[model samples]
Structures are given as structure tokens and as C-alpha cells.
Target: MKQAIAQYNEAERLARQEKFREARPLLEAAAKSGYGRAWYALGNWSIHGIGCRKNYRQAFECLRKAVRYGAGREALFDLAICYETGKGTSKNVRQAARCYIESMQAGDPEAISEVARIHYWGIGVKPDHSKARRFYLRAARRGDLESAYLLAEMYLTGEGGTTNRRSAIDWLKRAVDSDDAKLAWDAKERLKQISAVTM
Candidate 1:
């Protein structure tokens, strides 16, 4: 275990410095030696076309191995992304949603945002706008900027149920203040519309 941990740390150090060629072998070694994090990292490296040619098959295999070895939210989130995007397998929204839900249960903030997205968009299941609102609220309260923006949209459109102009503006303000530029821009647009309303 100690040796595996050392190799894993070394792999991380090498990868962080962008020494992809050297890091690959170290990560492989650590992953083969039963380091779950190494497997998960290696999976990401393969999936993102980083350091090596994009190989979804290899990424899926490595990520699955990671989950098998007790990888936490990171692995599940990546796996869900892959499923949703058809990276390794056929695009399977149901599978993606399941993985996102699992990751949320595991307390991954990104996963929470993703699950909220799935709910809001009705990606893999029947549209449940109320459920979407609940998820958005959860993520927004946790400071997920994307969710905050979604909450604003929902409020403007009355998507969850009743229209909430105040909540919409409040969430838009919060999203605009956050670091996510895409969501900030979206919030800005909504805020403009809301401000322009003659009441």
C-alpha cells in the first residue's frame, strides 16, 4: 500500500508538471498496483485526448476499474459524462443520469450540478420541473453558479411552478457575481429583460 501510494503521488507530481510522457507510465504502474486514484486519473487522461490519443474504450475500462476499486465522486462523474457524451459507449442518458445521481449522493458538487441539469432538461427521464427546481435550489445553495443561473431561468419562466421574479433576480445576481462567465452572461441577459419590464 505504501509503495502504491508513493507511485500514485509521483504520478500526480509528474502529471501536474505536464510531463505527460513520463507521467503516463507512472500512472499506469500505480493503477496496476491497485491505486484507485491513479486509475481514475489515467481514465481522465485517456478520455480528454490528453497526453495520449483519445481512446474512449481505454478510458471506460480504466474508469470502470476505478469505480470497482472504490473511486469516489470523481470517477462516477467522469463516467457519467462519458456516457452522456457517447465517449466510450452508445449515448445512454439513462445510464448517465444514474451515474450523476450516484455522484450527487456521494457529495460531488459537480455531480450535483449535473444531476440538476439532467432534471431541468429532462435528459433521461420524464420532465419533472418541480424536481428540477429542487435540484437547482440545492446546488445554488451550495454555490454552484450554473445551478444559480438555472434557478434564475426557472424563476423567469415559471418552470418549477409559480413565477418568482424576486428569486430570479436574486439568483441572477448571484450567478453574475460568480466566476462562471457563461452563466454570468446568461444571468445578465435575464436581468436585463427583467429590468426592462414595465411592471
Candidate 2:
């Protein structure tokens, strides 16, 4: 276990220094040694082509191992993504929703937001705007910028509750405070549209 931790730690350092090629083998070694986080890192790297060429199949395999090894809630979220997108696997929205729900129950904020999306769109589940709104609220309050933006939209359109412009404006402001330039810009534009309509 100590050897695995050491290898994993060294791999992380190498990755941070942009020495991804050098890190890959070390991560793999740790992963083979039963280090769950090492599997998680390898899964992400395979998906993004960080240290190796993009290989969705490898990513799917590694993520499954990560989940089985208790990599954490994030592993479940990524696995859910794989199921939804069919990245290196069969497309299964029902399974995707199930995994997302499990991760949400495990306290993954991203999973909460995704589950909200499933409910909002009736993706492999019944259309339940109220449940979506509640889930989005939970995610937004947990500091997910995208969730904040979507929740604001829900408030504006009365998707699951009464249309409350004030609440929309508030949530939009929160999204505008995010570091994500696209989301911040959209929130700002939404605020302007509201102002224009009101005036």
C-alpha cells in the first residue's frame, strides 16, 4: 500500500509539472496495485488524452475499475456519463439515470445536477419538474455554476413552481459571479433581458 501511494503521489507531481508521459506508467503501476484514485486518474487521462491518446474504451474500463475499487463519488459520476454518451460502451439512459441517482445519494454535487437534468428532460424518467427544481436547488446551493444558471431559468419560466422574476434575478446574479466566462456572460445577458422587459 505504501508503494502504491508513493507511486501515485509521484505520478500526480509529474502530471502537475506537465510531464504526463512520465506520469502515465507510475499511475498505471499504482492502479494495478489496487489504488482506486490511480484508476480514477487514469480514467480521466484516457478520456482527455492527457498522457495518452484519447481512448474512450480505456476510459470506460478504467472508470468501472475506479467505481469497483471505491474511487469515490466522482467515479460514479463519470461512469454515468459514459453510460449516457455510450463512450466506449452501449448507450443506456436508464442505467445512466440509475448511476446518477446513486452518485447523488452518495453526495456528489455534479450527480445531483445531472439527476436534475434527467428529471427536467424526462430522460429515462418521468417528467417531474418539481423534482428537477428541487435537485437543481440542491446542486446550485452547493456551488455548481451550471446548476445555478439552470435553476434561475427554471424560476423565470415557472418550470416547477410559480414564476418569480426576483428569484430568477438573484440566481442569475449568483451565476454571474461564477468564473466560467460563458455562464457569467449568459447570466449577464439574461439579466439585461429581464431589465429590458420590465422597463
Candidate 3:
């Protein structure tokens, strides 16, 4: 285990230096030693064409092994995205939801919004606006500014419950500080529109 971890750490250093070709063999060696993180790195790198040709199929296989070996929350999140978008695997909302929820429980903050998105849009299941709203609110409360924006949209549209303009405004205000520039701009625009309506 220690040797595997050492190899993985060295591979990570090589990757940081853009020596992806050299890192590949080390990652493979670590993965062969049953290191989950090495499998995860290989899977992620494969998809991005870091050291080899971009191969979603290969990435998917590695991700599955990574999850099986408890690679960490990142593997679950990436697997969920693959399942949700049919990128490397068949589109399976149920599987995506399971992965998202598991990732969220494993401390992946972004997974919360993804779970809400599936419920909000009814990707592969029935839309549950109430559930979506609840999940969005949970994420927002956790300091996810993008989730605050989504929650505001739901409030304004009355998707889950009663339409509350004030609540919408409140949520939008929270979202205005988002690090996502586009979302921050949109939130400001929404606030302006709301203000214009009252004036």
C-alpha cells in the first residue's frame, strides 16, 4: 500500500510538470497495486486526453474500478455526470441520482445541486419541484451561490410552492456574489428586473 501511494504521489508530481507520458506508467503501476486514487487519476486523464487519446470507454471502465475501490467522492461525481449525459455510458438517471446522492454524502458539495437538477428537470424521472426546491435550498444554505440562483428561479416561478417575489429577491441577492461570472451577472439582471417591476 505504501509503495503504491508513493508511486501515485510521484505520478501526481510528474503530471503537474506536464510529464503525462512518464506519469502514465506510474499511475498504471499504482492502479495495478489496487490504489483507487491512481485509477481515478487515470480515468480522469484519459477522458481529457492528457497522456493518451481521449477514450470515454476506457475512462468509464477505469471510473467503475475506481468507485469499486473507493477512489473518493470525485469518482462518484464524474461517474454520475457520465451516466447523466450518456458520455461514456448509457443515460441512466436513476444511476446518476444514486451517484450524485452518494457523492453529496461523501462531502462533494457540487453534488447537491446536481441532485436538485435531476428533480427540477425530470431528466429521466417524474419532476418533483418540491424536492428540487428543498435540495436547492439545502445547497444554497451551504454557501453554494449557484444553488441560490436556482432556488430564486423556483421561487419566482412558483414551481415548488407559492410564488414569493420577496423570497426570490432574497435568493437572487445571495447569488449575486457567485464566482461564476455569468451567473452573477444574470442574478444582477434579475434583481434589476424585479426592482423595475415594483417601480
Q: Highest TM-score, which number?
A: 3
Over 4 Å off, model 2: 196-199
> What TM-score does candidate 1 reach?
0.91
Q: Which lDDT value does model 2 have at 102? A: 87
Q: How do the residues 55-120 of candidate 2 rate in per-residue lDDT, one tens digit apiece?
A: 999999998898887786878888889899999799999988988998888788678889999999
> After superposition, which runs of candidate 1 have C-alpha atoms over 4 Å from their true positions?
178-182
| Best lDDT among the predictions, by candidate number | 2
Instruction: Give lDDT tens digits, candidate 1, residues 1-199.
Output: 6887888888788878988888788888888888888899889988887799989989998998998878866799999988899988789999999999998998887787777788878888777888889888998999888788888888888987899889888998999887767767877887888888945
Model 3: lDDT of residue 26: 97
Q: Rank the candidate models, highest lDDT first.
A: 2, 3, 1
lDDT of each: 0.85, 0.91, 0.91
RMSD of each: 1.8, 2.0, 1.6
Clashing pairs in 3: none
> By lDDT, is 2 or 3 better?
2
* Candidate 2 TM-score, true structure as reference: 0.88
Task: Judging by lDDT, tell me the better candidate of 1 and 3.
Answer: 3
> What local lDDT does model 3 show for residue 187?
100
Model 3 stretches with alpha carbons more than 4 Å out: none
